[model samples]
Target: MYYIHLEGVPMQCVLVWLWHIVRSLTSIEKILLRDRPQTLYDLSSKGTVPVLQLADGSVIDESVDIMKWALKRNDPEHWYKENFDHQDGLVNKNDEIFKKRLDRYKYHVRFPERSYQDHRADVSEILNEYNSLLEPGPYMFGKDICFTDIALMPFVRQCAHVDLEWFNSSFPELGAWLDRLKESELFISIMVKYPIWNESESGQYVTWE
Candidate 1:
């Protein structure tokens, strides 16, 4: 099963996207952080949503780890190809650096000392760097979709959402690249909303065929 929040939870969005890409059979539980269910707290009180509860009763809590687990089971796209370290490095940078800038920029009220433009500029540098990397693209790594593309797109989407006008005008290639992923059937498929979880119920399940 997958636990997700509807509003701008990039990790949850990415995990669901990866599952669709891998064609994995799984159920999903929608959750709101403000009203976290006991069932979720039972799994990992400290852990956030996007937890993947395996049938064996083990749980994968980290989003990237979940992506690796899903892909390892069946990499029909062969995303686990040569230069995997390089691909993983990109994902690491997105998680570590880009996401940090994103949070601060998006939730700038939490850090009143820093101006929104300062954080946005920091994130823009990261996007510009990615734009340079993606110059050879229709996708991130040459002509096809890869692990890095799938893993990073959701975060980029989040950043763009912060200011669509700035993102579109300032980062044209990056904007265009994101547009492709957003328009994809794969992205659209996983974005289907499930009912929000109720604490008293056993909850609904969404299994793959």
Candidate 2:
């Protein structure tokens, strides 16, 4: 897995780590994008983070695509068994719309057209929509955590951290949902800091099984 560590989250990398934990997979090499060798670009010209090269020499670059590939092999918790359309719908909204607003809000100075408050208001609208979805209790679909929950959790966490006080006050349900996932054993395990991978030396391999 090749990923860039940003604010200690490394968004998409953590998504793949969640699947790896549930599937009991083993032997993944963690490479920092900043220290990635030219071989990585040779493998995929797109040069994105969280790139996974399988034993079969096939590559999976997109984050959600990597999640689907892993789950297809083993999904003991049945994360993909139910809510197919609903899951896809929410994940798409998160990746496409919510992420854009989040980036703008996070780096509002880069987007001079909109004030920081305007960018935050745009994100708040989407957060409110997701908050309403958690109407009665936990998780996106129901009590059980499904594909949608895992897919959107990291991004929501990023937004919440921007202003945690406001997030908790404005959307308690969403804040709670983020906290539950953040405090999980699985989340904690993946968060162990590894030395930055270097081309001149052997990189760190995280054994998941």
Candidate 3:
């Protein structure tokens, strides 16, 4: 597990960590990306965090791909059941549309073309759609947590944290949904802090059994 820490919390890494907890995956080395280590470049020239290198030497780099891989191995919770096409569509919208607006909204200074409020409004459009979808209560697809919920939660959390007060007031359903996931045992367990991976020192090994 190669993960990036932002604002003292795992970003994309949350997806992999959540799946690890759900499936009880164990003995995985957790490498914290801090100063751009050479080992990271060696494994993946892309230098992106949340890179998973299996014992067989195969690498799973993308966060969504890693989630799918883990579910394929052991989905005791059956997170990847029917309605995969719908799930994939939602995930794609999150990764493609929501994520872009989130970055702009979160870092408005970098995106000068739009005012901070405008960027925030752009994000709200997507949030509004999700808020309606979640009106059935609890989760994206209703009742049980599914792959779509896990895939979108981290990004939604990021968006909410941008302006929490506004989020809480505006998207009541979505906000409550996010709060539930944040308070889950799985979310809290994966949030354990690890020392920055040092070239000379062994990285931390994470396991949940």
Candidate 4:
């Protein structure tokens, strides 16, 4: 979806799920493998990448809905639950605010006049809030490696790319979090490859164990 929006490819289906899976479980995933949906339940007028057609012929156009349908049927490693942050769910915080700041900062060029630094300052302030709540074990909280770690790592990855040397120098703890995610086979495998979603020659999915 990101690829399609970014590069403007006439997105077909899930030829690139972004996240890795050995096999397709939901019929939607499988159908996407063969071809992308053009008119999901006659909802093409709505417009979206994963307009999923259900067993009852109902269609869902949201990304989260599509993922829920596909993964609910097959989540052996519990990545979804872990990523969701059922307890306290600080990951939701990171996803909601941190990622938004990171997005603005990473794409500051679109905003013009304002530099990436302007947006990055907001991201930095949020990270500092996380840091304030942190206790050095490297997780958001004192010792629990919660969903916050998993949910927020991708934007951190993109931040690193924006300026690895600068990013590493500024936020050591955040860098460490990024390092942990990068070292994990789940993140690397799921993130490193994909059809780039027809956008920036990169995909927009992440999977984990």
lDDT of each: 0.74, 0.74, 0.75, 0.51
- All predictions: root-mean-square deviation over Cα? 2.6, 2.9, 3.0, 7.6
Model 1 clash pairs are none
lDDT of 2 by residue, 161-193 (tens): 899999999998999889988887767767766
Candidate order by decreasing lDDT = 3, 2, 1, 4
List residue ranges in candidate 1 displaced over 4 A.
1-25
Candidate 2 at residue 198, lDDT? 55
Candidate 4 residue runs with Cα over 4 Å from true position: 1-89, 113-115, 132-134, 141-145, 195-209
Q: Candidate 1: lDDT of 29? A: 66
Candidate 4 local lDDT, 155-208, one digit each (tens)? 567767888988778777777776875676655443322242332223343333
lDDT of 4 at 24: 32
TM-score of each: 0.88, 0.88, 0.88, 0.57
Estimate, for each residue in 1-209, the C-alpha lDDT of model 1 and write its tens digit: 44332223454335434455343444556787787777776786665757767767877777888788777676776766756888889889988999898999999989889898889889988899888877887777778878888888888888899899989998888888899988887777666656776667555555565
lDDT of 3 by residue, 122-168 (tens): 99999999999999878988899888888888889988988899999
